[model samples]
Target chain A: MDAKRLTLFAGHYGSGKTNIALNWAYRLRDEGRAVTVADLDIVNPYFRTKDAEDDLARRGIGLIVSEYANSNVDLPALPSQIYSLVDDRSTYGVLDIGGDDRGALALGRWVPSIIAEDDYDMLFVVNKARPLTRTVEDTLEVYAEVEAACGLPFTGIVNNTNLGPETTAQTVLASMEYAESVARATGLPLKMTCVDKRLINDFAGQVDSLFPLDILELYYMQKEGM
Target chain B: MGEKVLMKGNEAMAEAAILAGCRHYFGYPITPQTEVAAYMAKKMPKIGGTFLQAESEIAAINMVYGVASTGKPAMTSSSSPGISLKAEGISYLAGADLPGLIVNVQRGGPGLGGIQPSQSDYFFATRGPGHGDFHVLVFAPASVQEMADLTGKAFHLAWKYRMPAMLLADGTLGQMMEPVELPEPHDAFGTDNPWATTGTNMEREHNIVNSLYLSPEELERKNIERFERYKQVEAEECLWEEYLMDDAEICVVSYGITARISKNAIAEARKEGIKVGMIRPITLWPFPNKALAAAADKVDSFLSVELNMGQMVEDIKLAIDCKKPVDFCGRVGGMIPTPDEVLDHIRALAEGGR
Candidate 1:
């Protein structure tokens, strides 16, 4: 796993950013590192980092959630605990931000303190299967909008391409050229590529860095064994 | 055949329309369905087509009316509230007997509702979308691939019947992504429409497109003729799908995303040795009465699963003539019933518990 003191995950709503954040937090906890995840998503209601609070707690990870998280209320109350987590240098902090410019404002509130600390990586996760980010130009445009809104530069890119449960090994492999095109245009390093663990064998000796996904969303859905 | 590529349902609908010879599009941005207009804005110019972002849904529908009267293929799309605003213009198009397409990627509604998927607009789409004694064909697609195929079907049917057709999809179908094989692009709208409102040019008789009639007798005559045409459509264009319906005790009736969810529930029920099946209506306006009536003869009962509060159940009941008890399982306000919940409903009905 790529280790950083402060890492930010930002993407479009259905780009699977929450799952990537959860995976990173779980991986860090598995390695016996102090991990803290802050749910900075207030725009979308269906999927969020707070949904895995119990699993996160079982692994000895701390979670910072809004007062009105997972409800219909529009109030954004990111508590002060998030500030201390960012300040704590010994712990790894992952912020799962929401999609679009309006959602990036949640991250803007912490930009001053984040720049003051000066050791962070904001990764713009791209799903080539998504409508708006299918092309290199469209993905760059979305990246620029989020950058302008949150006042942060995306240090790297992660090609986390999938079609929900219908994802296949071919789907992830087909995005390699597209991801390369995006990396070439933006001059950002290709940080990693994420895919379901079932397809890890197909990607052997292919990608530079591979993050095997555990299908957290489907696990939650079928948890009751229905 | 175009190569298979993954696409969102909304963008696929726009690409399908372009492939079906739709050169003119007028739409306003709304949640869950805005991708359709955005895709058109990007692709239409490259293909030498017209993509206009109208000021409002009403203006977009009126623009569709204008282009349609000129015998050109045109379309517009919106969500629930925006669709409600296009009601008057839809009535005008139907009254004038013009061919066009309208797409409704429905979100929750009654007012400016939430942005999640909902199927609450069944009654509005199938019964009285516009005003008075008019029928607009409605096709419901359950997947990203169907989203493209059905939009192409809608354009063809619109021209065949010289009437407005609707692709009634919900937010889940609009936002979800899947692999699809797109159709080949059509050349142009045929130039043989005699009733088109093209300038006379002194070589042919003058053509006029109007829905107004001063005499009540003439208006009544037009309405009767349109009803006759609708009867012909009902006889021919009622499309539906039956899944594992052979030798089943209960049938689950659904369409669009809800139907996709129901298939999962049906498979679960089958594992427990309960013979459950499905009848998915591809055309909602025709309502697939013949298929439902036929299923009523073999199935013990029916459970209509929807993302709305029992809207399509009334049509099912009427179709079967209340021969078998019809029950409803639904969720409202953008809430979707899980596959386990739907399976529980099926079990209850099979056990004569509902």
Candidate 2:
């Protein structure tokens, strides 16, 4: 499991990008690498990486989110701390880009610096279970929109197809062809398939580059019986 | 029915409204519930439906009124402040006996409150949204699945009763994601609307839709007639869910997200040897009084859990006729009462501390 200096997750809204970014940051930290997560999500009012701020801090991972992330203000204000991602080359940066083209627009300011580094991996996360990105054509449409908005092309495709808390091993298995089609259509490498940690045991030898996710959003609500 | 998919409560309701034959949607965006308007804006045009982002919440609801008057399924959604702006239009829908789906994905507020989940609008919704004497059929969904299911139900019931129906959701429910099996697309717009203001072909008299009556006698008669329909609704349309109510000495009353939190509290209380249960009102307007009244006979006491400052406590007292001690446990101004907080309340009640 090799990670670039910077790994960015961008996709359509509700495509599980925030959750994947958090998981990737944790993986980087566990591998004894200095990690910092920059949440450039101004599009979504709920389910930002900042929701896991305390957990990230405890794990020795630095987090940079909107100044008004969970303040209920709904202002599209990104933190100035995001510049540290590109300026500070000593730490591994994981970015949780906002949902859709509107969300990805926040990435425009950092694109030049990130491109100068030439080592960032911007992965387009796809979830077939979402209503909007249900087809290959629709997924590609979102991919193009996100890329156009952020001025960054995706170098990899991550199959994050899920049904939230109801995701099953079979659901992941069934979405393989769809994920492969997306990867093939975009001519990008199939970087990984994200499976919920609860179901990781079910995909022992069947899948490659299987990334186990400790779904933080689901954990927050379901743990509280909400 | 469709395969299970992950959807936010706001998006699920928008999709469910479309499935229920709501071809017309008019709304102004507000936080925590903006996904509803966004989803409609994207899907409605593609489906040949009308999705208009009106100039204001007031204008959006009036657009709904216009479409609903023509006997088509129309809807509008907003958060707390936005819903307040549409109050006059909702009252007009009720007064004119027009069927329209009005979704209030509530946020904390008296005036432009913060954009966080709050059930503080219980009184605003149940008592009547506007000045006139009217009750909009209100459905509070606790889960994302119920968010989609009850949306279809709200449309069906609104048309059946010839009045406005509101899907009362809080910000937490509106934003949270869960697996939901969406309802099959259906023509919930009833075929028989003799009072609809569809242009009469001169074969029949023009159907007039109006709430204004100059004559006092005519206005009184119209009010009485609407109340008669409401009586029928109260009797046959009241919806509620009773969880572990049998043989329980302590009853917990809640709805929407608070109800989900209470269930967990009830489970913990039960494990601690407290005989506790829950009665979740699915229909807030109809109030589920009969169920609460019956629960009063079996339970020693009741606890009303809410996200507001005990707004639903008054309704619970009225429902039970003050038969037993009713305690209130709640958080206000967008604060959610955690399961442990609710459990502690239940434990105190069980110990006769409150």
Candidate 3:
């Protein structure tokens, strides 16, 4: 897979953008590249990239997030450090934009610099499992809303459909047609299909551009063997 | 049961409410629970339902009151501070013997507290939501599945008892994602409600839905009648889940997100040879006094784990009739106690430490 200098993920709420962005950053880091991941999510009050700050730091990856990221204050304050994502061309930058048009509005401010560089891939991550985006038409509506809000055309589509921890190999396989339909409608390349790392063995020679992810253990406090 | 789907707790509850025949949703957005309002705003209109983003929390709840009076299942959701603003309307719903669903996805609070998960609103919900001698039914869900399942149950029980009900959740449960088998959709509005203020086709007397009583004697009578129904609720509807309670000596009590954390602690404690178990209260208002009372006779001591500063400890003591030594372990103001912290507390209790 060809890696871009700037990889941005944006989609509907709870569409697995944060997980994808984090995994993408880790992949870049593993390739011996200088990677920095930014949390551009201002709409959501929880479950942002900052939640994995220590993990990112341990991997020797840079993180640029809001000052009020994990605070009680739910202000739409973007940190000034985001400027470095564009200014520092030497480092690879991956961004997890917030959900929907309101969340994508934050990307509008950085559009000029990003467009001028022309070295980025803005991927529209779609999840067929989310009730609102189950259909091809619905997914495109969200795609158009996000693109218009951020003032950037999506360069590719990523199929990230899954049922949380219950996601199976069949779930990813079944979502292929939906993902292809979305890509065909938008006239964008189907860059990748995200599969749970546990289910990667099931997709052996059948799938292309498969990005395997270790599912984010969000509910680690939950009792085991339940 | 339908195929399982992944959803955040907030979104699960909103979708569950819709499936349970709720056609009207009135709410103002607040953190940890705004997804409820957002989900409703997008889907309600497409499904021929009413979704109104009222001017304020107070207005939103009053709007729920208006819809519920028509014998239709109506709902409103908010976080800690917003729920406080809706207190008056909640009390009115109880006083008028009207059934409605109120969801409080709690964040830390006294005044505009942080947007982190906390069980600080336990007293606010279990006691009375508004100014009156009444109790609203409260269901605390620990997982995304329960968030959806209890939503349907809350609506059923609220209408069955003709009282307001609350799905009390914390920030962690509201924000976290998990797989859930959603309930099948049903039309709750079509049910026959003899007490509803629906227009009588001149064939029967007009039903008047109200809470105001002019005479003190009449007001006292109404209050007593409401208590009678609450008594029936206590007898028949108390819900709780017991984990590894058999042959246990040290019992742990918790609800909502804290219960999930406590379960992890209990599992570790068991591995280390501690006989600790957990009794998770699904129904907070009913309180599951009988289960605790039964366990109190066997357990040497009790630990009340909470996300607030000992709000539920008082109820734990009352439930067990103060029979055993009840210890309080908690975190307040948006901080959650880790499993290690709870395990450490359990370790201390097993070692005879306070």
Candidate 4:
């Protein structure tokens, strides 16, 4: 397995969080890395990391760390795989956090601890198409809220702007530019750009490497009929 | 199978039961849970389902008792206070060993607790829910999909074990709207129910589904048998999540919404060079205490954060047996502690070397 980066997808509600987060996880899992995902969405009740469990399980991606992972009571926390994999040096884990600034704060407890020594990447996922986030100021306000809540500087930004199936390459590039500007201002890296499953080619001109939509699990489901 | 649609927790759960062949629903309208009754009212007749908005929580629960006795899938839901009123019925369901789906889109409570989401019912749900030596299979959902997914599972578990099963959700999970890919509707259940109060004519002898066994020996036998089932549930069904605790020096323990916040806290703490992690429990009743206990063994400290004041904190202490300093993080009533607030607690815990 390839050595993996500890990538975190952080954002607000309806900000294409689970879509982008799940996409990144799918990318890493398919590239021959021992990648696992944990759903920490105790904030909202929609498409979350755990919603993709049965599908991810087919890709050999560990979706739950709780013995009661399938049950309700959404106590969002780190999974055992995180601790077991922390020292293993072979496993790469992705934690899909909840949406909302409140969710950003929820993430504070884990950030400082995961990278106590090793370097890891925390990507503040941004979607301009979302109503609450229409401009750089709005995104920055979110950034500040999350940073303050989490008690740490956001290290990177992932431009994940897509209006679902209607999104085009132009809008995707524009969003990438916006995220890069924020990254430059904050001194954090402009991490991967999150593109929709149908808009993967739109990033060819602007992004060096844009994470694809859940192509990993999609490919598996198609091939194995799982 | 029907076409796939995007649904919310409250909407999806109501539909899931109908898909599970449960045509009967009884409930009282309450915030966060009003959608369940509304959805049923809108769709029950379309697909030949029974929907009722009872006069009170008591009436709704009794309605459930009537329908559940018929051996078909039956259910009811309410907010915290309404759920409290249904405690009498919940106890009866347990005593009768009758399978039912009782949902609580928990709102904050002591009396009419605020209409916001809260998990303070950890005690009410895990304990008998009312006055009785009984327990219910409680599933706490962190996301909407689980709200739908677990509803189906709750029905199956309820019938499989012949017990009352509750989906303990909070107001947030109930009201939130996220993209949920609903499963296609399936065939109605064909399995025969052995304990339902169906007529004796042409069928087997009458089966009385009630919790009024007053004989001490009979009560003891029934309670003992129920305990065996609970033990099996504890052994086979306890569920939870652990994050970054393997080499974690400090662990943040939380559930539901709070757990999500704590995760971000861990992410932030890690960036600042602290080895903090998280432990979230999915099953509040059949708690994954063993997993948490194991987590405590590895971490130097544990912080139990909740929307209430130290309710779940006590549970954490019991599981780990004071293996480490267990710090409590909370914003009582209806206040949800921000991730930074939780981080501050963790920072203090780490700085203090707990």
Residue-wise C-alpha lDDT for candidate 2, range A31-146, written one tens digit per residue: 99999999898878766787888899999999998778777687999889899788999999999998999989989989999999899999999999998888899889899999
Query: Chain A: TM-score in each candidate?
Result: 0.94, 0.97, 0.96, 0.80
Which candidate do you rate higher for TM-score, 1 or 4? 1
lDDT of 4 at A79: 59
Better of 1 and 3 by TM-score: 3
Model 4 Cα shift for residue A65 (angstroms): 44
- State each model's CA lDDT, in order: 0.86, 0.91, 0.91, 0.73
List of chain B TM-scores, one per candidate:
0.98, 0.99, 0.98, 0.94
lDDT by residue (B1-354, candidate 1, tens digit) is 765666878889999899888989999988768778978987799789999999999999999999999999999999899999999999999999998899999988779877778899999999858998898999999988999998888888888888999999998788766678788887435667888888888899888788999999999999999999999999999899999999888999999988978899999999999999999999998889989999999999999999898999999999999999899998888778889899999999878832
Task: Please report the TM-score between candidate 1 and the true structure.
Answer: 0.88
Error of 1 at B119 (Å): 1.3
Go through the candidates in order and give the clash count of each.
0, 0, 2, 56
Residue A74's lDDT in candidate 1: 38
Q: Is candidate 1 or candidate 2 better by TM-score?
A: 2
Task: Give the best candidate by DockQ.
Answer: 2
Which is superior by TM-score, 2 or 3? 2
Error of 3 at A87 (Å): 3.3
